[model samples]
Target: MSISKNLPMLSILAFLGLWQGLAFYLHSPLLPSPETVARIFWQHCQSGELPYHLGMTLLRLIVSFAISMLLGCSIGIALGRNEKLNAFFDNWLVIFLNVPALVTIILCYVWFGLTESAAILAVILNKVPNVIVTLREGTRALDKDLLNMAKCYGFSHTKTLRHVILPQLHPFLMSATRSGLALIWKIILMVELLGRSNGMGYQLHLFFQWFDIASILAYTVAFVGVIQIFEFAVLKPLDNLALKWR
Candidate 1:
């Protein structure tokens, strides 16, 4: 096999080796060996507990991600296109952007109670501002010359949006998507930890109380692996497909 393909596996093995060595040297429960973590991971998978919690976290992530993206893109495009509106809303964007995510999560829970809606809203409020900032810049950076050409061709609004606007925004869209995936999951974890009854975050919190280092590492590895799989399988392919037009 090529070095590139083998490199990742080799790197992982090397990491496990290092972890095992460190665990042996420390001889502490605080740092478990990779093998110990793997055993706990497999046991959790068999018990179905890990999957259920993962699913709950995944659901919250998806719902919040979709809402943030939709609202962010719409408002960002509108503000980018209209100077007066942008000026009016600019402070609002800045305010939201600067607000601490933890504060937002706490506020949502206080105002709306510890419901799922509150959790989801906390995520959306935290994420939408960032998406708006990225997309607004992308919108402003759009090539006016291409826009004129589209206009000269008498492209309908829908056609222009699909064929002209979206393609130009692809880079920004992808940027928002990547960042959103990273940021939203963290916020979801915090939300679950603070208020929710079940999720990877809650499980992690439980393990933390028990000082179950192996279980903590196991769940963390599982979630990070899933995120990596998504980036490689879904995001990368979609990005490549989008770029083919260029």
Candidate 2:
């Protein structure tokens, strides 16, 4: 079991070794060695720039995620529970889901004039439909016998949802969350690239102008490291804890 787990880390080290060998052979400024990138990444950390900008990006991710999940789950549950509401919103949901995220982001910026609200709103708009679709399916697939049992036991709406509905919906919610994080972070970077003054994306843009591949890679490594830590330290733990009842 330990060997299986360590295999991924070994593969990463092997890949980095290959990368280092290539950088040594090419000897190009454009493709700095991994050690060079790590040195630069350390410099940025010491300067405090990386921490501040990365924090900004993470904050946006949290805010937009909260908004989309709450609103989407509510809307999805309502639609799923009501045949008429589902029919009315079905096409609109399809429209939102099918719309390109870049188009939505650009439109929000145009209409809202490149403000923070616009950035967050664009992210929420892009993400909400996906959450809704997942949750709506979960709601639809809910066991009728379980619901009827709850009804027979005089379970209040809130109680029924908490103990019965939500427990069954856990898988769908987890699915939405995993996909949402994967998607929202990339879009957040794009949002920052297009408008924001500070973030990993904005910093990367500056590096791009100078053709500083090392700085770009440094930022990429630092930010992606943070994200990986968050996944392992936060998301994975929460997932395990939440699903432990099963």
Candidate 3:
């Protein structure tokens, strides 16, 4: 087997063995064995309760990620093309980047009254700056020679963009998308946990209230599985496309 497949299997086996050993040695209900967590996950899956909560969380993540990408890319492209605009937004971007996501989410809840909109807005606000930063750097790194050649050839703006700028921007855009999506998904979950009523985060909070560690692990595993799917099915394919020209 390849190292990639072998590594994951080995890690999982080691984790399960350690969990079983710990549970036996400690003899505590506080920390459920891995088997117990798997059983809990299976039971919830059979009842479809896991899917309901997981689907809702994924929906919120998608919505927030979409909004962040739209606004972030627009602003990034504009600022990248204009030195004055870049300078103006630099300080604001710094402030947003430095601000803790939890604080931002709490402030949104306080300002907007603990609603789903507030949760989404918090996630968007936290995520957009990073995307902007990445794309802005990409914009700054664009080849002047390519643009000058396009100008020399008297290419139309649309043609120049399609043939020159877009191909150059693809790598940067792909990087920004992958990084932004990963960060935003986690932040969205945290925002949901802090302020919302229906999501994996809320379910985690419910599990915490009852000190149900197995259920918490079950939810964590389910969410993580979804993230892996996104990385493989969406991000990986896009990465391959973006780098194909290279």
Candidate 4:
């Protein structure tokens, strides 16, 4: 347990040490020392620049994620329950799932122009198919016996959904959300980089143009740290809640 607990810190220290050593060995201004990068990161934090960009990026993610979840789950439940509808849409869903995200994003940007709406839509397009596929499988696997039992007990559609279907779908919803969050955040960043005035991705693009490696690394670290916090605080709790019965 102690070894497991210490592993992350030890690995981080090792990485920092390696980075510092490489900077010293190379003796390049472009390759700043870890301390220098940390100092720069601190300055950005003090100025509140990092927090603003972080908040904006997170806002976009929340909007995109919420929209994707709503639409994806609706479509998934429909398709799962209706064979004809599923057969009709199966090919389209497969195509979207298999298409490259970059291509989709580029085409979306061209179609909608370089706007926030376009970027969010691009993220949705890239992420929704995944959620649909996952939830559809879950819906298809639901126990008909339990559903009939609910009907036998005179449960309404709402009641069945609330007490019967929802419980079975919870795990799949959690799985979809977990995977979607991991994927959509990165895609949103890519959308930001491709076109947008503000975001972590835009900042990273600006830093790259000037070859500011430290700032680039700082932005990346900041975003990754946020993702970790979300995983532990939000997704972990949801996963526990969903799997509690199991």
Candidate 3 similarity to native, TM-score: 0.89
- Tell me each candidate's RMSD, in Å, in order: 1.5, 1.5, 2.3, 2.3
lDDT of the candidates, in the order given: 0.95, 0.92, 0.87, 0.91
Residue-by-residue lDDT tens digits, candidate 3, 182-239: 7887887788788778888888888999998899999988988888888889888877
Window of ten residues with lowest summed lDDT in model 3:
237-246
Summing lDDT over every window of 10 consecutive residues in candidate 2, give the lowest-scoring window: 222-231
Question: Between which residue pairs do clashes occur in model 4?
Answer: none
Q: Candidate 4, TM-score vs. the true structure?
A: 0.89
The local distance difference test score of model 4 is 0.91
Per TM-score, the best of the predicted structures is 1
- Name the lDDT value of residue 1 in candidate 3: 56
Model 2 lDDT, full chain set: 0.92
Off by over 4 Å in 1: 1-6
Ranking by lDDT: 1, 2, 4, 3
Between candidates 1 and 4, the TM-score winner: 1
Task: Show the colliding residue pairs in model 2.
Answer: none
Query: 30-59, model 4: which lDDT tens digit per residue?
Result: 889988888889988999999998889999
Q: Give the per-residue lDDT digits (tens) of candidate 1, residues 1-246.
A: 698889999998898899999999999989988888999999999999999999999999999999999999999988888899999999999999999999999999999999999999999999999999999999999999999999999999899989999999999999999999999999999999999999998999999999998999999998999999999999999999999867
